[model samples]
Target chain A: MCRAISLSPNSVLYAIGSRSFEKASRFMLENGFSPETKVYESYEEVLDDPYVDAVYVPLPTTLHVRWAVLAAGKRKHVLLEKPAALNLSELDTILEVCESNGVQFMDATMWMHHPRTAEMRALLSDGQRFGQLKAIHSCFTYKADDDFLCNNIRVKPDLDGLGALGDIGWYCIQAILWAADYDLPQTVTSWHEPELNQAGVILSCGSSLYWKDGRIATFYCSFLTNLTMDLSVLGTKGNLHIHDFAVPFRENVASYYSASQFRVPIMSEHSVANDRPQEALMVGEFASLVVEIEGNGSKPEKKWPEISRKTQKVLDAVRASIEKGFQAVQIVS
Target chain B: MCRAISLSPNSVLYAIGSRSFEKASRFMLENGFSPETKVYESYEEVLDDPYVDAVYVPLPTTLHVRWAVLAAGKRKHVLLEKPAALNLSELDTILEVCESNGVQFMDATMWMHHPRTAEMRALLSDGQRFGQLKAIHSCFTYKADDDFLCNNIRVKPDLDGLGALGDIGWYCIQAILWAADYDLPQTVTSWHEPELNQAGVILSCGSSLYWKDGRIATFYCSFLTNLTMDLSVLGTKGNLHIHDFAVPFRENVASYYSASQFRVPIMSEHSVANDRPQEALMVGEFASLVVEIEGNGSKPEKKWPEISRKTQKVLDAVRASIEKGFQAVQIVS
Candidate 1:
């Protein structure tokens, strides 16, 4: 993430902070941070820096609200990594602070800013090409090694407590929401037999969502399977497919497949090349938003934060459905 | 189907039958069947022919039992089209008579005969490449024109009574079962909001299945969407993807994609060339099984019958789930 920010033309990896200055220093040195980059022993020190216009919070999901709120309070633009927070309530808290303080807030979902994503969006919104969305299936899974499963922050109940559902599942849910043009689902239902660790953190799970208009989406996220990322969006007239969705196989050129009303359906692969990595683009996008607010005295962009909140709400509903023994949980919004 | 049977070197298109002699004659002429091929005014006439070793029943769901039973009673090998019967009871009656008569029974699920399917099965069974089966998603959907939606046999309550769930959904359910090596799921649950016509026949729907081992599968079938047929099988160690699972894009060569453990996950597309179309291969396989029974005095192959039964069972379960308002219906076998 630090490297991603540094790669952005308008962004800089200005500071490193951790409870341990040595660990932060090691991270800075190992990641080839500039020698002039500031190192702070406490997160408070980074937020206190007068020259720091923004702070990127890459803390575990459990700490998102605290750190993001602090950054917002300090008048720092907030770029928070996903899953944005443990739940919607926490995310709302962070967003509220950002709103009150006039700080731009965007979660770090790199794929959202990829050039390939824009190409996919273009095809999906074209009625003649894609028509009305019917169903979507998004999956993101990775085999987590024994060491990581046993000791990773993701599996720890106190850290990224949502585990695979929050870590990778967020991407899947986000993809579904993104494909649906951010329309909130009317109902959410989790699949039975969600794999959970001893601490009750989800390791793997799946859920389905339904819209009032009869459109539906299903997603699966797992830390117990071989690395696979797929986003398939089917519409009345066409289809959109992305295999390497969460992360592109080739960073520079991302490829997607689409077909429109073929007498014999045949998907044609379309590739979009980016001048910089997707993460860099995400950083650049976020940085530009922060620039607009800080330099032009513009209000913060609500789009990114609104997207984050919806993703968080859907995630919470999925968790609720899982907890309620896979019952259908109605989404009020 | 006549063309497929004629293409197989060992299987000749022996007979055509319809209620109308003119219709049967038209079919025989259109397909360029051997001039000596018999055209019967009724299905029973074709079944009663002493030289006809096998009969392919392409009748609608309501008529399957009567015609299949007649063929089996006449000691003709029964090659039944998919959604073999209205439900398990009907299929069981057909199977029982075939068993009693010592005649071969097989469903006309053409993809099962594709060489590419065998390659996919090999990879899925390989513990090193694919590991234990985890999740599957099979979707087969096609847009129905105005005329078809209003007048097609598939949409009629008394014809293809199962509607989309029986027509195209049959292929999706069969694909899931075939990928799972015919292990029946313990529970089946339909997604809410299945689209239905005025006759209460499903036009579009989806269902999810669960095994006791925590493996899961979901499938979507529709007549209200663009043409899309996909079978995605995800295992612990690898993934198998087939875009055109129900029908191959090319008749001579079929393509599929698979990937094993990769730190950087990547899918490699593979094409398997076939001497004939999958339908021809299916007919050839069924014919060979019949020949073994008739010539070698061997018992009918139990594999194909069992596969067809299981597919029908799952399809029935999905209907029950949908009828019961998307409740999870437990499978006895």
Candidate 2:
């Protein structure tokens, strides 16, 4: 939904191959896109479309690598949603293909693009305001609907990846990583509610990330919960809080305090909606990237592998913690 | 301090043999109690006093059993603050002494007397409001003050009693046990932060309790944190939330909701001070108990060992979990 709407004005929408071409055509038409948009009945048809300069692969978790590789084979830039792939190996494969094909590939993590989040990161990182970052805490949770149990991609581990952690925890993992300037943690210990479908699939999860400088990050994610998105960072001098990151009009406020004193009115950032922006501002950024790719051969932005690998490492540690019932799991990197 | 303030109206202060007599006298005078108020510095001096019919033992955690037994042997009713003792055997000793001497002993858990908490318990247990409770989640954390750390009795394994779980976590444990109608959990699993010191005892602690009927209770306690007290319970029909049990006035609201639909407000029994009146209410309850003991024989309203033993068992399991690091420890009823 986001991809079809985010393309440049002159960009062509090359519909991807799915189980039903007519349904895909109707989807495009309903969303006000031209019905004449090239509709591919198979994966090869979409890849072979010469007019298609970029592909937005919102496929199942397991299919992420396969589709990204196929898109890269056709030299098409790609935007993949969270949990880039099932594991680091698949992520590595996607990265290798995209890099070798000279195509721009980026994970659609819109959380970092949110203006409120940017403001928070700035306050926490600025040594004058918060000093050295000490700890990061986050919680992202929401109850799933009825169909979520039976046919949802999230429940199907092979498709949606890991349960709660992979789906929502990736945001928390990214939050900590981004706050610490992508500094990977050395150790991770986690605990998960055992009633989850499998040992690895958690209903509610908690983890602690230990960094080299004695800094730590703790996070909680749950599928069976009321909707909540909260991020808090404590530093030597002060602290920063971002209330809600996922929603546009949600109450997003960042506050910094020193020596137990409120310093100023909490800075407020209002999210700008480009059009049908449901998930993240990343859609707008991805749209800009498409223009950049069309104008120049490459983007000056950071490469995909650098950030994707860091996220993959956190996800891997989180998985190991869940499997080990939250014993300290070493981050190989 | 609580005992002296509670007995202020009686114009009599009983100081058991533990601290210096001059020190007790100075403490009483500093607190605005009359210096002439009877201060028997020794345990025998206080017990032999015809005016001293009750005792409040704020001794070390391990000495609770010994002092309570001695007070009971002297036919003095007792109000002993938590952890009850180091173990169940000590509690048994106190119980036998009280029974033989015909003196009453009650663990001083003031949370039970908080009017709002009483209302919360009734609403949840009403069956029609919350149905059969399935789960309870609680957390209590606070950054330790300098004085608390300098005179850190809680750090001493035998003196301060149990770490976070025994001191602050005991409140959460009691809340769960009371909510579950004293039905002990069949299995318990726990995790504790590795570091413990005088300045910061336990960084973070979590315990999971599993009952025979599938009811689960989970709680977290930390001394190295900003103050937070929150509790939530989920049942078959609806859910209940007690924002802050210890200090009810600090945004404490209890309500039951089903499927996003608001039910009737779980009526909170409003005491004179519904806000942060826990301290005063605790003093009043103890004073009333003192009056009951003086008016009648030593026996008051409830026995101590029954509740103390159950709490100790839970604390023991939490300690085992801390030692085992994520291993489930079964509670032997």
Candidate 3:
């Protein structure tokens, strides 16, 4: 995030915070923060800084609710890390505070801000090219080394209870919703037998989402498989596929495959090159929204929060489905 | 099948039987069958021909039981098109006849004989590279034009009652079984709201397969979506994915993506080029097995029938689950 802010012209690495002052100073030095950057001994100190316009919270999932809610209440635009909270209700609390404070709220899903995403979205929305979405499948997985699997905060129930779903599956869910134009599914059914750690935190899992109109989406996320990031969206007349939906293999160029009609023995491959990485672009986007609200007298961008809420709602439903023996869990929201 | 036979050194286009001798002769001519190829007006006459070693039944699903059983009873090896039968009982009857007559029974799933499949199988079996199989997802779909949806035998209930599940889902179920090393799942649960035509034939459907050991597989097949064929198999340490799994984009060269361990962001893409199309290779393999039984005094190969039976059983279970309102259907076999 600090790197993104450094690369983003619209944003600044204004402050660093840690429980220990020494750690904050070390992080600042390692990340090449400017000498004028403020150093805080604690998160509260960062939030208390009157000059701070927005705060990026990269704390553990367990800390998201408290920190995000406090940051929003402090009238700072909140750039929150993903697996925004343990559940939807917690995220709702943070969102409510942001709304009341007129503060912009956006999850740190960098891929959303990539230029290639807009190009793909254009194809999906084109009736002649993509048509109506029928099915989608997204998967994000990485082989976690023994040490990471055994000792990482992700595997700790108290830290990131959702594990792979929260870490990587969040992106998959977001991609599905994005492809579906944010239409919420009626039910979420987790695939049976999610691998769980001793602490009952999921190490790997998958789920199928069903809409009332029979449109469907399925996703798999794991901490046990080789690195794979795939999103395949099938439409009535076309299809789109990307192998690297989360993080691009290369810094400057990203590619996705698309096919329309039946004239394909080979899909048309599209390569998108960007001047800056997606994270930096994400930082720029969030900062732009902040500027609109803070300087241009514009209303805070509701699109970001709405998208995040829908993703969280589905995530909560998936967790419910897992808890209910992989049965279909209705998404009331 | 005719093209395959022509390409295979061990096989011959000995004869073609149709209700109309003129139609049979026309088909033979169109497919480049030699002038000496025998044309029989009746299927029984072709079966009666002493020179014919095996029969490839590309008849409708409803005709499979009678034709395949008759071919097996005649001591001619049976190469049956899938869905092997409308249900398992019909298939079991045909299998019983084949076993009694000592005839080889292999479903005409051409991709199974592709050299690329064997290469993928080797990777999946390598413990150090792939590890334990965890999940599999396969989908086969093609947009059936209005004429096809209305006039095609595949949409006719009496001819192919299983509909999309039988025609395309057959390939998907087969791929899942192949990935799982033919281990039948304990239960099959059809996804809710499967799209059905006015005649009560499945237009599109999906299902999840679960095993006692927590292995999971999901597949979707449709006659409603644009052309798409995907098979993603996830293992503990590695993963394999093929976009054109059912039919290669190119007849000679096919590619699949694989990654093992942490060296990803770039999956190793492997391409296998075949001297003949997969169908020809399938015919070659089947004919070799037939030759072993007839010429070498060897027993008819049991492996082919076993794999076919497993695939049909799963298809039946999926149909049963759909019949029972998307409830879980146990696989007694």
Candidate 4:
């Protein structure tokens, strides 16, 4: 995030804070933050700085509600990392505060801001190329080393409680929603036998989502499998396949295949050669939204918050499904 | 099947049969069959021909038990097209007769005979490269035209019976089984709300399979979506991804990607330079087994029959899960 802000034209590494002053200073120095960037001893001090326009929260899932609300209370726009609050109610509280604060709020899903994202979206939405979508499957998995598995915050119940579901499943769910144009599924059913750590944090799981029109989406997320980001969107006329949906091949290189006639793999010809990296673009996008409200006195865009809320709602439903022994949980608005 | 037999070294298009003599003659004419090929009006005449050592049964699921049983009874080895039968009982009946007659039995799942299949199997089985199999997702889908959807034999409950599940889902289920090294799942649960034709035949459906050790697999098969054959086998160390698992790009071309340590895609460098197409290889394989039985008095191979039975067992479990309101159906046997 610090590097992204440093590279973002609309944003800057204005202030950073940690529990330890030395750690904050070290982080700033190591990340090449300018000498002018302020390093605060405590998080509240960062929010207390009246000159700060927006704050990016990279705290664990458990701390999102508290710090996000506090940051919003300080009238600072919030750019929060994903698994934004553990559940929908907590997210709603933070979003409500941000709404009342008249500050922009967006989750830091960097891939959303990538040029390839919009290019893929355009192809998916094209009637001639994709037609009506019938089904979607997105999976994001990576092998977590023993050290990380045993000690990572993701496996701690009170920290990144949702574990792999929150860490990588967030991308799978978001990709599905993005493909479906954010129409929430009518019901969510977690597939049976999700593996959980000793603390009961999910290590791996899968689910099936059903819409009213028979359009379905399935996703699997795991911390135990090799890194795999496979997103396949099936339409009536063609299908879009992305092998590296979560992380691009290189920092800036990404490509996909569109197989319309089943056997024939049509590699997408045009590569997205964007100069700015995705993280920088994401920070730029969030900061520009903040600028709209800050300089133009415009309202915070409702779209981002709505998307976050829908994703949270579905996550909550999945949690409920798992809790209820893998039954289908209806998603009531 | 006729074409495959013609290309096989041990097999020949010795006899052709249809309901009408002219239809059989025209088929032989169109396919460039030798004038020595006997055109029979009745299927029984071809089976009755003592010179014919094997029979390829491409009949619909409804006729599988009848034709395959009759063929086996006449001491002709049976190469049945898949969804081997409508139900396990039917498949079992066919298998029993084939065993009694000492005739080799094999399902014509062409991809299994492809050299790429064995190459991928070798890769998946490698402990260092793939580790223990963790999860798998396979989907085989294709769009059925309007006329075909309404008039096709597959849509009729009395004909293909299982519809899309029997036709395409067979490939998906078999692929999942293959990736798991033919270990049947402890339980199977069908995903919710399958689209059904007016005759109550499945047009699209999905299911989850679970092993006792927490290995899981899911598959979706559809007749409503554009042609999509995606098979992803994820293990701890690396993952194998095949975009066209069911049908290759062309007759004899196929490839896969293995992305180990997450983002690094390691495509297998050496492509299998097999000269024969998958279907021809399938017939050649089946015919060679029959030759061993005929020339050397070898007993019918049990491996092919067992694989067909396991696939049928899972299919039956999936069907039961759906019938029981998507409940988890235990595979007791």
List DockQ for all candidates. Answer: 0.83, 0.12, 0.71, 0.74
Candidate maximizing TM-score: 1
Q: How does candidate 2 score on lDDT?
A: 0.66
Worst 10 residues of 3 chain B by lDDT: B259-268
Tens digit per residue, CA lDDT, model 4, A126-227: 888888999999999888899999898999999999999999999999999999999999999998889998889999999999998889999999999888
True contacts kept of each: 0.76, 0.00, 0.68, 0.86
CAPRI-style grade of the A/B interface in model 3 = medium
TM-score for candidate 2, please give it: 0.77
Off by over 4 Å in 1: B262-264
Interface RMSD of each: 0.8, 6.6, 1.4, 1.8
State the weakest 10-residue window (summed lDDT) of model 1 chain A: A258-267
Residues B106-218 of candidate 1: C-alpha lDDT, one tens digit per residue: 99889999999988889888999898888999999988999999999999999998999999999999999988999999999999999999989999999989998888999
Each candidate's lDDT (Cα)? 0.92, 0.66, 0.91, 0.89
lDDT of 3 by residue, B96-215 (tens): 999999999999999999999999999999998899898889999988999999999999999988899999999999999999999889999989878999999999999999997768
Per-candidate TM vs. native?
0.99, 0.77, 0.98, 0.98
Worst 10 contiguous positions by lDDT, candidate 4 chain A: A261-270
Q: Candidate 3: which stretches are off by over 4 Å? A: none
Clashing pairs in 2: A190-A326, B17-B42, B17-B43
Q: Put the candidates in TM-score order, highest first.
A: 1, 4, 3, 2
| Winning candidate number (DockQ) | 1
